[model samples]
Target: MRTHRKVLVLFAALASALAGCSSGPNQPDTVAGQFADALNRDDIAAAAALTDDPTRAADSLNGLYDGLGKEVTFEVGSADRNSFTLAATWNLGPDGKNKWSYTTTGTANDTGDGWKVKWEPAAIAPGLDIGPLTYDPVYPKPARILDASGGELMTQQVVTLVNVSQGADTAAVAALIAPLAPGLSAQSLESDLAAAQGKPITAISLRAADIAPVQAALETTRGVTLAPQTRLLANDKSLASPTLSGLDDLWQKSTAAATGWAVRVPIPDGTKRLAGQDAQPTPDIATTLSIDLQHAAEDALTPIAEPAAIVALQPSTGNVLAVAQNAAADAQGPIALTGLYPPGSTFKTVTVSAALQEGSVTPDTVLPCPGVANIEGRRIPNDDNFDLGQVPLHTAFARSCNTTMGGLAVKLPADALTNAATQLGLGIDYVTPGLTTVTGKVPPAATPAQRVESGIGQGQVTASPFGMALVAASLARGSVPAPALVKEQPGVADKTPEPLPPNVDDQVKSMMRETVTGGTATSLRDIPGLLGKTGTAEYIDDKHAHGWFVGVDGDLAFAVFISDAGSSGPAVEAAGRMLRMQR
Candidate 1:
């Protein structure tokens, strides 16, 4: 029994010794645990001190921390008296978009009096034998803007922005760059500089060809800096300047979603790819514009001296085919899509539709075609007061008899014109992507005088070229269509109008055809199946007028507007030119 006791006591002593070895301060696992804890807390000094070579370890660890963006997590995967493995994960970028994780193997050595981790670069990451590590990001190519037929419209181009600091040499900078850019002057630069309030103002952004001649001189100028920026620009600036400017925001959004990044090591020649993802660009953005039609519209407006614009749409699909404006029109902004003006005789179409819907008059009903009539104290007159005694409503409409339309309007309900205009897509608000538009306003007329004026489209009634185009489209399609610019993003209208009655639609269409055939738009009659209306809207006074013509040829609906044109002849001629090219 004494011998058994002695054996058990010896066994107990041996177990206690093993336990002490595992938990003692000199144990290799204790050093490994401490090293991992120091790394977790980002204590580079403490972690390096626990390594065999403190200086070398500190240098490598500092580089690792910086290269990994200072966001790292270290966990002890396996640990023993002499060997250990650590799981390291790094958060490399914002929003947790980039992460790198790997397991590294290292050894702990007993240094007679203490235990320390061996200094090896592999302890930080697998296959990492160098002193420094780097994270390199790769960006994808920007997406292209495509037309409805998959033709490229806009692309990423590099442009240099010339910025002037608060104390910059304004005179010298302006003089050097003024000739390169149009409409820039030294006096204007100084005035703009004073308004900057100590902030740097960008004088201009120039294409590569525009700035190549002065690039060297501008770079040396004091308080001036040239910054290169990648921007989405039209492949042909002359095609659709106003419409293409609206697509920049959408282009940037698509590019960001497909951006890719990578981690790489710097070599003597260039960079050695380490771990990364290759950039894959997103699909091209498809717009509703037809490039061929856009070019044709632009070409047609080139001969006009006044500020003229043209807006075209596909009546069947409500796709915006073209929005073109001449240089004279560009100075006034995107007037083709947003500028509101008195619609003149173009609104007669709406009035006639309203009259037909009320059953007050059919296309065959006889109405007085007086040259001038005092309807509720408002003097309504035909073009040049030319009278054509009692004729059918369709005949009076085709001839654009204002007195006849005013008489019909004064007899109907107050909200008749307003409702008709909305049904034709003039008053409804549209939220279309890649385009900002204003469809003009048509207010309800509560009195005979107001109705007479609204009926002839002269008072409190307005429509944009885009709105007039929609009117023509509605008549052609028998219903109002939701407009769209981007193929995938159809516009949402604020209100859904009821479809036009079949009888009303048929009657209006027949009158429009008669107007082009033998009415005010006979000039465009050469084009087959063309239906149109011409307007000479008086603004401010009777002396100056804006010319307008809205028409539909098969599936194509368009509006041509010329500011201060004095008559509708110029607008009709421009429309003829535009339509002829499409054929």
Candidate 2:
């Protein structure tokens, strides 16, 4: 009986100790863990309920969660009855790049019902009790685009962005905005709006001048919003608008590196910055374009009614000096640099160069230039059937004798012209930065007929105005210089062709000079020491042709093209007007 009583007493004492242990240190640790779990779950109310002052804790927790409304986690370290280490982290930026992590001490008190965390702002952050936290973004200023003379070519400009909700009256929106936005139609706007399905769709972005007439009306319309935005734009709207537009993308990329940010506390007077980084200044982008020459080219092409373009380069360096196109040509896109057209007699430069390299003929070698001739079953004719019979190779080239060139092409190897064009920078691929370009394509002729057509720049022989300008530059420099627009960033060509022989270079230059003095391009003879070639390329039919003139004056080499001009006269005249400005 005594042993049984002792055993019951001992068991009772052990039970009492176990109960006390459950309600003491272990309870505090359990409560701390529950609070951390609640916070990690974003349950501010549940987390506050585990605190001694629930109301105050709820207020601070709500503010902290709302102010930094991003991903957050709380980890509770080993806890005693009094305190525990709380590690908190908030992912405030993309991919946790701006993560804020810190360790704070949390206190727990024994309330009558259970153990609860002691309420204090320091439990969240060391100084979070001061006020609510906010994220302040610091935007870096965009870089300026500079011309060759170190003048600003592109700058930030304010514009209005118009948007329409899906259910808005797209017809009314389109009718009001079509006048300001080119190529926008009511039917297309309605279709796009319906496709967006309640999403806000951008109607148009209008400059100040473009929005002045429609701003009030657009603002009054329902489901419409007009937001002002800053965009990189040309200083002068007329100065290489397409090129500047492309540079805007590059400007955006340059500014995308680092966006500064600050964590602040809002107070009665002004916010106190807790931590932040200052934005880095972006460097200015330099281009190889000459302002004066670009303006000159633009002015020279203004009077032409048809689609016309001009491209000029510095032969010594292959730096693009100017690229200008008239409004008609602009409607067709950046034709001065990318558009391909039959080079016509301008390709005689390549033909003659190829023949010279093949040891087939000299500039003085006699070739027959008939009004019309059938070579390899292909009919070739001189301009207006006016032929010079039994003329020197240089005279035939200057006069652009298609029959002579076609006959010479039929006698050469298949890839001769292609190789020559590559050497002259025509068929070579150039990955130029800040500018998207296609020099041209000269494929190898598989048949004599194709060769005959390719020789005169008709069948498979096509070139951009930029490519022809490069050809002239190569003739002037005795080799093709790598073309580039961005300073210190030369284009990487796929093929590094050797320079032409001095004899071939001199012969081509002499013939081109004769072209200006007495041959087909006599119209430009007034421009002293001008070397050029005239071309009339038939397209679709023999009645209509594109006019071409590639020329060199001093260190400047240029090409002028007039679409559907029916003759090379207009191109020659345009070239003369352009060169007259250089003097």
Q: Estimate each model's TM-score.
A: 0.73, 0.79
Cα lDDT of model 1 by residue, 293-410, tens digit: 8888888899999999999998999999999999999999999989999999999989999999998789999989888999999888888999999999999989999989999999
For model 2 the local lDDT of residue 4 reads: 14
Q: All models: lDDT?
A: 0.84, 0.84
- In model 1, where do residues sit more than 4 Å from their true spots? 1-137, 162-179, 184-204, 209-226, 262-278, 303-306, 538-544
Clashes in predicted model 2: 0
Q: What is the lDDT of residue 310 in candidate 1?
A: 94
Pairs that collide, model 2? none
Model 2 residue 344 CA deviation (Å) reads 2.0
Q: List the residue pairs that clash in candidate 1.
A: none
Judging by TM-score against the true structure, name the best candidate: 2
Assess candidate 1 and give its TM-score to the true structure.
Answer: 0.73
